[model samples]
Every structure is written in structure tokens, then in C-alpha cells.
Target: MKPVITVREYARLTTDKITEPTLDLAQVSVSAFDWLCKLNATFSNAGAALVQLENRCLLKLDNYVGVLETPCGTRLEILPKHFEREDCIKQSRVLLRRMIQVSLDLPTREVGAADLQNFDAPLSEWVMGRFLLALDHLIKRGLRFDYQRVEEEQRFLRGQLDGVKQMRQPPGRQHHFQIRHDIYLPDRPENRLLKFALDEVCKATKDAGNWRLAHELRRVLLEVPRSRNVQQDFNQWSSERLMAHYVPVKPWCELIIKQKIPLAVAGEWHGMSLLFPMEKLFERYVAASLDKDLLQDARLKTQAHTEYLCQHKGKNFFQLRPDLMVLHQNKSWVLDTKWKRLNSSGEDKSYGLKQSDFYQLFAYGHKYLAGEGELVLVYPRRSAFDAPLQVFEFAPELKLWVLPFDMERGVLLGAPEGFPLHSQQLQSSEQSA
Candidate 1:
């Protein structure tokens, strides 16, 4: 027997990598908290909030970012002040690796800058995974959350998302799945009649082992049969000859028609799809939303102009890394994705301006020269600041953009405002960044 699979089961396992216990909201997912905390250390406020969300709450956000990228999808990167700090994992290198992979894999074949979408995956799962693994390399890394609390807490959040209760029955000896699907066929009146005629012709042809009969039957049903024999010119038919013609195959027509279908069938397969349309709508929404990130990801692989590299001379270092790198034609700029909060005003600012970020980008500008090229910093969208696209200058032409992201909405709208820069975009970028 096939093992039972439900949308609920898929969600639980994929979300938690576990089957039983489900998930709780109040206790917070330990894995989520740990991941967010570590993300905060490396990325920032975006990291901090991700953990808080894991605890359970009705949250909605929007964000966007613009960056100049390397061919391997490297965003222009700058190191934060607390580099290698105990709480932080060194993700800059791993992040750069993602940029590099995207740069090399681009369909355009450019060098210094490419979109992050290309590089974000392989690196996130592999390089980033290793980095996280190394972060846990310490003997002290222990559980920070309890599964029971999170499961119990999950109740409150269910009301906010659809299909949360499509839960599976407890696992048992009988493996099973809640099969769900839906189908839609053209609904036009003409289409319905055509479909009906086609079905009848096919049914008749099924008994005769002839496919040409089906084709001619289609024409005949539409009402145009010029002659009794297959050799007869269908062209000779008058206007009224077509519409409801259903000529069964003629013996002589078989001589002219050499091909036939061993089996004939008709009508849409509705059983599979009809079983579940609501579930399909939900599934479709998920797929559409997820794909938004893939298409809008601005991780671009762009190569510096020959002149830009030649100026660097000895350091023609075959490799360069930049996240959120922006480019127009051959001109380019760069930025990095940060998950941390941007605290402009506060007695104890959780995250303020990082001198190191300025210094790091300054070098990239000094070498890559953003004033000549350009550089920017991309961050997740948050409520801490309203209308959060702020610009800071390390150099005149080089700028930093604290873009917004809406993780739920995707880039289906022609040129959606954010550069993978919506709330959903913000979340996905920071997750990989």
C-alpha cells in the first residue's frame, strides 16, 4: 500500500523535517529560533524578526532591494563590525560562493554581476548548510525550544493561513494519502458542441481502429463533407455541408488513409482533477508565490568592464563577489542583503550603521569604484521603519538601498515595485543571503 500523504504531512515534514508532534506556536520552533539568531549575527534585523515570527503571530510585511551583482550573482558585499563574533557564523564567504555560482551559471554568460536567483540555491543548501553545520560544530550547541509548546501554540496561527487543518490522521499500519486534484476545460458553447461531436466520432472510430476517421469526423461534425469517398474533395462542399456531418469510414477511404489508432479515446479526464479543486487552488497559490522569488531574484552575474579589471592590474583576481549588485547595460553597482533591523534612532540601537560595512564597500568601490560603477545594500522590509528605501553614500555614485520585500506576493505584476524586493522577496533573499 502507498504511504499516506497529505498537504499537512508534507508541510510538517518540510517545515520541521519531522512527522509527529506537528508544530507549536507559543514555544517557538527551536530550529527556527536558532536559525534566526544566527542569521541576525550574520545578516541583521531580518534575522531577528524571522525568529520572532516562528513563535506565532499574525504578521504581514513588504520589502524591496536593488543591487549590482557579479556574474556569479555576488552582491557587492561589506563585512559587518562583529566579524567572526561568537554569535555570528561567517556567511560572507559562503554568500560570495553563491554569487560566484550564479555568475558562472547565468544564461547570459556575463562575469562580475548576475542575479542572485541563479546562485542562491546550490549555495544555500550546500555551502550555507555547511556554514550552519559549522556554527553547530561547537559541543555546546543545544536545544533552545521544546516541540510540545510550539505545537500547542500553533492553534492561534491556523486561523490566519488556509488549509492548516488539512491535518493527517495519526500514522498507522495502513499507509495512505489524501488525494487532491482538479480539472478545467474550455467552457465556450461552440467548444462544448465540438467536444461532443469529437467524442461521438472517437467512440465510433474506436471500434474501427481508424484515426483519420476521427479527423474527418471532426470536419463532418462541424458539417463539411464534400464526397462519399476519402479521395473525394472536401473542398467541393458548400457552406451548409459543414456543421453536423458524421461520415463513418468508407472501405475505399481506407486505401487512401494508411494510418489508424489502435485505440481511440475522448473527453477530458475529469476524475483526477475533479477530486480536489479547492486544494488545487491552494497548491497553485503556493507555487505561484514561490516562483515569484525565483523570477524576481536580482542576484545578477555581471563582469566588470575590461577597463575596470585592468585598472586593478596585479589583482585581476579571477574571482570577485558582490550581492545586490546593480547594472544597467555594461555599467554596474553592488549591494548586500542584511536581515537585521536598521535602528536609526534608539538609546540601545539593536543595529545601527556599521563602520565595517562602510569600510568594506569603500574597498569594493575603491577597487570596483561604485562612484564610477555603483554599490548598494539590500535588507528585508520591516515595520520598524515606514517607507524604508533609504540611501547612504560611501561615495557619490555608489549608494545603499534599504529596499522592502513582501514574501507572500511575487513579481507577477509587470515590473513589480521591488527587486525581489517585496516582503516575500525580502524573506527569501535574507534566508539565502
Candidate 2:
């Protein structure tokens, strides 16, 4: 049976995340340690550090205070991945939610420089991460730069023709300069990888402190600029230009601030990272889909999420506005979005499930039951084509599938809850890596 874990417990375990990072200086059984590392378990990658003397180690595990260890004479550089650990993934999620909310609460007027710093930076980072993913997705699918404007430059080579009218160099205000390196998009992977690679390049670049990120990239190749984190600064610096090209994210913000629910804007509000790069389990993931549904039915797709409620509540009162609910062929089913984790064996995760979750679904089943009222818990997956999907039966003829949203790291894997794979599925790195 899959272990059931609670969201409350996950938060409790996450409080000490990033607080402890350790290095161990001790003599331990090398074979024992190696075995752990092989399981994607935490082990000292730098085991040789503690060969002779004790060293300082940062312990990041939950409720565990920092410790100094000298096992024997060898040193160990170990990191923990377990129930209690400071994970970057968790931190990113929390920051993203808060930043989105904060941005929504601000006045509709142009968010000022102060606003950009106080709120936009964090939100900008989240958007940037999403943008990075989108850019990655399109690039992998053979997308290129939108449009490039190039002009022919005929170089005036010296001595091309004997006695060609010689013109003396006149010193004047230099209005323009030409770039040397031919700027052309590389092949697919290279183009898709450029953003991520550029991020790394910007970090190491001596003039990174001088780099900026306005709507368009402008290079001051003539005189290199200083370096610092300037992506947001660039965006704001070129706000005038940006406004001319890109519409403000107002309607989207109003839904969250005024409505507390960020709705879709022209069906482009919610961008799917899906399995192409990550999971689309958040309520925001369906913003675009909801907008379309609402447009068609005029009243449908309006559901509960903090300040709102869906169709009806059951006797047990487990409230849930499913990711999607539609009446089809005189019947309706509730589709719920779920993010999943795995164990070393690549099987369904029982670790993160909470008992309350089952009850909530039970309520949905009771209230939304039609025929064998269907309820699907959707998850992001690699290649569903490689493995057989495991299903659980809630009742006789009543099925609930913990299905996969088949999206590759960059390509569209499949669809929501639609496992587009055969029974012979291959295990993923979620277990072995």
C-alpha cells in the first residue's frame, strides 16, 4: 500500500529546510555509504575529505541541529533527501504563490520601481522560470527567434582598387557600430538551451552586474557594462518600450486581487509546464481552460478556491472544485490535478498521501456521482508509452485512476489523465536516478 502523507505534515517538515547543510569528517564503511548513494539516497559525494581528520558538516535534515563529525580519517560530503529536508522545489513553490498574490493586491496603476523591487522581482523570477520552460518547449520543437532584421554591409577594404578615390578618415560623433560575430540561431537543442546557458553565462560573466533584461536584449558591445542582477531592472528600464509591445497583466491580476482567483486572459493566462519540464497541478494551471469553458457556457467552470464554491457540497462537507468538470453524454466526471513523487523502485508513491485526501474525494464521488461517477487524479509523467498504468478501484464498477499527463521533458507527452501508452512501460529516473 502507498503510504499516506499529509500536506500539513509536509509543511511542518519543511520549516527547517535550508537551515542545515553539512560535511562529515569521519571514517565510515565506504561500501555502506556507496550503496546509499546508488539509490538516489543521500551520501557523501566527497567521501575522501575525512580520510585523516574531522571536518565541519552542515546538517539540513528537519529538527536536526548542525553537527561536526569525524568518522575515522576520511571526510564525507553528504546531503540528505528524505521526509525532512530543505528542498529547493518547496521553497520555489511557496515563494511563487505569495509573489503572485502580492502582485495581484497591488494598485492597477503601473507598478512603480519600488513595486518592482518589493513584489515584481520575486514574481518576475517565477514568470521567468515559466518563460524559461516555454522557451525551452518551443525551442525543442524546432522554434526559432521570432524575426531577425539584418542589413547588408559592404566593407570598404583598403587598396581594393589602385587609386580608388581615397577618403581621409573624418572624426565625428560615431552614430552606429556593427557587430562582428554573425548572429544566427543555432540548431534546435542549442537554441532551446540558450536561455538556460545564458543564465549561467550571465552569472560567470565579469560584466554580469551590468547586464539587464528589457523586452528586447540590447548589447552594449562597444563598452562593456558592470554586472549585478539586472533582469528586472532591464524590464522596468524599458517599460515604455515594453508597454508598446506587450499588454499589461491587468485582467489576470484583477481576478486574483478582486476575485482572489486568477482567471485566464484570452486563453493565455495559465501556461502549462506539464511533463515537458514540470507538473501542472496547481489550480492556476487550468486558468485558460476555465476561461474557455466559461465563455462557452457563460456560467460553467466557476468553482470554489478559497473565496468561491462549486456546484454543491456533500453530507461530509469535503469541499473541492475539481480541475475540470463537464457534462458529457448525460454524465459528468470530476478531474483532479495531482502532483506525485516516487520511491526508489519507481512505483506509485504512498508517502505523500494524506487520509483526508481520500475522504475529500469520497465526498466528490458522493456529490458528483453519475452512473459510476468518475474521478481521476492526474499526475505528470515521462513516457506513458513505456509502462502500464496502475489503477485503484473505489467501488465495483466505480473507477478512479491515478493517471499520467504524458508530456516529455519538452514535447507534449499526452493529455490530462490520458495515458497514451501501451502496457509495456519503462521505469523512470524518479526511481533509479
Error of 2 at 179 (Å): 55
**So what's the TM-score on candidate 1?**
0.27
Model 2: how far residue 365 lies from native, Å: 1.6
lDDT, candidate 2, 1-433, per-residue tens? 1111112111221112334322221223444233212321221242311111112221122211111112222212122122233443243334333334342332223434344344422222333333333333333354332233343223443222222222322354122232222334332222223333334333322222223431122231112223243333233322343232222332222221122322211121222111100122233343333333232322333353422224455433335565556444455556565544433234535634456656666656665673275666554443322222455567875666554433211111222232222221222323355
Cα TM-score of candidate 2: 0.33
Error of 1 at 191 (Å): 37
The numbered model that scores best in lDDT is 2
RMSD of each: 28.7, 19.0
Instruction: Output the lDDT of residue 335, model 2.
Output: 59
**TM-scores of the models, in the given order?**
0.27, 0.33
